[model samples]
Target chain A: MAQVTLRKLVKMYDEVQAVRGIDLDIADKEFIVLVGPSGCGKSTTLRMIAGLEEINSGDIAIGGHIVNDVPPKDRDIAMVFQNYALYPHMNVYENMSFGLKLKRTPKDVIDGRVKQAAQILDITELLDRKPKQLSGGQRQRVAMGRAIVRDPKVFLFDEPLSNLDAKLRVQMRTEIKKVHQKVRTTTVYVTHDQVEAMTLADRVVVMNAGLIEQVGTPNELYHTPATKFVAGFIGSPAMNFLKCSLEQAAGALRVRVSDTLSFPVPADRTQRYTPHVGKANLLLGLRPEHITETRRHTEPNQHDFDMKIDVVEPMGMETLVYFSVGGVELCGRVNPNAGAAEATSMKLLADLNNMHLIDDATGKVL
Target chain B: MTDTAIRAGAAGPKYGSMSRDRRWALRWSYFFLVLFAIFFLTPPIYMFITSLKTSAEISAEINPWWVFNPTLGNYIELLTQDTFLRFFRNSAIVSILVVTITMAISVVAAFALARMKFWGSATLATGVFLTYLIPETLLFIPLFKMFAWVNETLGIQLMNNWWTMIILYPTLTVPFCTWIMIGYFASIPKELDEAALIDGATWTQTLTKIFIPVALPGIIAATIFAFTVSWAQFLYPLAFTTSTSELVLPVGIVTTLIKGDVFNWGQIMAGALLGAAPPLIIYAFLMDYYIAGLTAGATKG
Candidate 1:
């Protein structure tokens, strides 16, 4: 039972803080992914957990034991690098068995574990081939096999799939998820790709500027982002934000986006949003999928408005329509057959049930 | 003429000119290649020819380059002579010892400088290569004096000893070998060692098992460099060792075979050919690795 914990973890290179003070608790058997844009400290945090980087001032505990001074090998952790750092001279079997041999594990036990890992990764046929003889995907499997043969407390992957081609990357994503389901080892995977994070992680840790923006399950982060950064980062066609102000209209709060466009706050959030009525620096944050073509039957708080489409992108199953709202460009997803063409007007529905009101001044979602 | 014949005649001159240009280029390339080959190979061929000739026929001068009557007398005499055998033995021992010592010190030093960087490591790495640039011609004088001082102060003879070459040769070979190895070691991705560290291998184990094998080509190149440098070196052995029994091949053959206006041309050629054999055989076998290691150092890191 190896649950990793970090308390006030900080890393500094010269005067630059690569990782700011952060606290986290990773439960046993949990698969956590740290993801963000480049230089957001995700890779640095993973390296620190692997004991490859020194903590500037913090405590890292694995299985409830402080491992601040423990070396990487003694931490009982395995890391798969981006480049698949397999021994070029060693065959796949020897590569998998290197760690065990280093620990002086018995020959038969090492053999059994390697063969078992090769079977698990479905690389048994490649046991005799050297690393150079393997394809890129096959080499990636051998790297993972090398890590799995150790059966360590935690598996640390440092952007292990970043080197594969696009199609191979998606294929390996499912392969990784399947392996995690079978092995059930606590894993920490880092990547800048949000889709990989959402698909592979049990919970995603969204980081920005050396600080974690939010941590939650994929659906939680997508539907209810706590910060503007998280909302913008977690989706493919990112959530759109339009400059607006909340105004009190009779007993309801209306989010006024422009002279002709305004959305009434959903009834469920009226109480929470009433205090912020007439507040300046307000933004209407809504996802592209929430604003779509007017449906046959409208649900509660769904408002219909006409938008002159500025651009159109037909993406096979869905069409992305772009239009101007208060001088800010906004995107909406409609059915591909809805005929979203550039320079054309279409009646679109704005679903306020999924709308987010953000305080642009502090970048907080209210 | 027929229509096809007229078309073929019109196109022939243009196509024929291109082929003529290519043929001339090929002829000139081979011309210089053979010229350079003969220029470089003539001396060795002449040495082999002289080694096969008797001293009487060599002096007759009927045709200096040709052997009127060839004999194995020179080879047989040198092989039987205890002094010549001793010179061969001394050269072999010195070269083998220097190569071993040079590799041991340089491999570890290069690994430390390239991977396990510390304070001033970059400057020190550059400093090592700079030391190699300080030609041995300049340092040999100082080194000769140092050995002299050691002899006077300790009452132990440092001069006229073949074993002293073992200590002196590494000063020349280690710096350059370490420089070559530093390039090779630096070219290996940093993730490799980090992976090894997480795999439970200590620094020593990583160097022995992972690095040494991966850099084997560089090691072979450095070994050849060390072996060749020490085997053919002339100035240090001549300056330091004087006695007949205390000489290596280059110094031994020159000092003994050419005594006071009388030169043993046949025996000298035979000795020179035999002395050249070991390095020739090593290069012949490991030439590809030697070239790879050399170019990798320049291009990789």
Candidate 2:
């Protein structure tokens, strides 16, 4: 395992810059994930690190050597593509052993590696089968087997779980995690799925519009997103963004979440953001699960808002109640037994104490 | 097949006359097959029949559609003639040489254009494919003049010989073969090359080991096209080579088999039939591969 450092790595296709400039330092044996939407340049960054694409301006140093001119083979990195990229012409054993054969390793070594990988993946029976003959999950394992047989310095995965069905995706996700844990190889994986990012990454690099918005542990990003985009993207059902203004009320400050609802700002955050109160147009961010029935809330975590419930989605353990605050639809998770009767108005408790404030114009965290 | 059968079963009860409709469909299919067979087979059949008839019988005009007094004399005469044999040999040599040369250049050029992404690669690829559309008829005149100039300046006569076709047929074959190969190569997934690249295979190794084996059908079709074009090239051979010894099959057949007012109609048909055999045989056996190569783009990206 080796550390990978990308210094101002930029990828430009003529005038359209896919990745403007990204800087990252991945520690040895770290399972770093680059997570973003389509066109966010996460895959491009990963490809550049893998030597699959040329960097426009910058340097990538893997294990303390600047490998700007290295080809993929010379870079000693193995990549697993989104499509699995298993050679359709070869059987599983040949596919897994391809790299070692190309490297001119001894026949016995190649055979041993292939056999070991096949046994580890529980795919020994599939050794003679072609990629087309295998199921999607089996193909994914073969792709991994191909990577591992090389014993490369780094492993690169570009949406490797995307092509499989839902159940297979989860199964492969865990398999990949276990593989990384067992091998402890420095790896860089790219995926657009936030749930996958959250569960699979040691540290997630959240990208937006070809720029790195935030990079932290999954829990850090989910519990305290650094920007409006990160907050919205890192959560399922997304964080609700409501336009609000700060106003002085009772000698302190209040966040006016809507025309009819306003909550007094918590004592701790007022000093940090309300210096220009009553004038600043702020964005109030609340994740879906943060808002719930008052009965489920304890003292310091509760703030009530009278709202007109729009939709109630009864997800087995909890009900997702969608309502409007300041003309924007907001979702709040509640216990299923809350009996959040359909289409009626109700008082909802938002953990306003933990709410995030972002600059309305810039989407910057306040 | 299964999809059609299942759909037909689903529609059977509603239609009420499924078996009757199928029988009529089969009858119509047979009727069209007969019509098409007559349309396609009549010319070759007539040529074969006429080839077996003697010159005297052809001249008598007993029945235009019927052959009488059939004999193999025309075939015997043509085979015995030294000039006809020379023409046959020259055509065979020229076509085989051209096919070999064309396939070599076209295959490498196609591999470069399809897989390699060097500087100016995309523009060069477009330009290469576009060159195929420049007609051979337009190119031949300048080429003829250039050959004459070469003979005048360099003291070497490249024209009035069958070997000149070895040089010219590549112009016709390379671009088209290369274009077809590019389409065929592009139809293969890019991921295959990536897999090969990571597998530590160089571009050449990957091409020979992985792509060439996979794209054999395309190579076969291109080879057949190249060979057929070289063998059947009448305009270039006729325009350049005029002497009896230098003449190829097509021109030799017309010149020697027809003398001023009289035509050796039987031998002419026999020579035409013989000349058409090789390509017909190649296509008959590998028709699926030829169609597969042509329809690669339609079936794949």
Give me the candidate number with maximum DockQ: 1
Off by over 4 Å in 2: A247-253, A267-276, B1-34, B63-70, B76-82, B118-123, B288-301
Q: Pairs clashing in candidate 2?
A: none
Question: How do the residues B1-301 of candidate 1 rate in per-residue lDDT, one tens digit apiece?
Answer: 6999989977889888998999999999999999999999999999999999988888884888888788999999999999999999999999999999999999999999999879999999999999999988898889878887998999878788999999999999999999999998988878889999999999999999889888888899899999999999999999889988999999999999998999999999999999999999999999886565322211112
Per-residue lDDT of model 2, residues B6-95, tens digit only:
899878785768778898999999999999999999999999999999878888848868876778888888889898889899988988
Isolated chain B TM-score per model? 0.89, 0.88
Q: Which residue pairs collide in model 1, if any?
A: none
Model 2: per-residue Cα lDDT over A1-366, one tens digit each: 489999998999899999988899999999999999999999999989888788899999999999999988898899998887776667889889878887899999898988888877889999998777777788889889999889889999999988788998998899999998888899999999999999999999999888999999999998888888998898898888888888886777788876678877778787887665765668888788779887643676468766779999998989999887656888999889888977898878878777998886787888
Residue-by-residue lDDT tens digits, candidate 1, A1-366: 999999999999999999999888999999999999999999999999999999999899999999999999999999999988888778889989999999999999999999999999999999998787788889899899999999999999999899888999999999999999999999999999999999999999999999989999999999999999999999989999999888887998898999988888898999999888888998889999999999999999999999999999999999999999878899999999887889989999999999999998899999
Worst 10 residues of 2 chain A by lDDT: A293-302
List CA RMSD, all candidates. Answer: 4.0, 4.2
The CAPRI class of candidate 1 is: acceptable
Alpha-carbon deviation at A65 in model 2, angstroms: 0.5
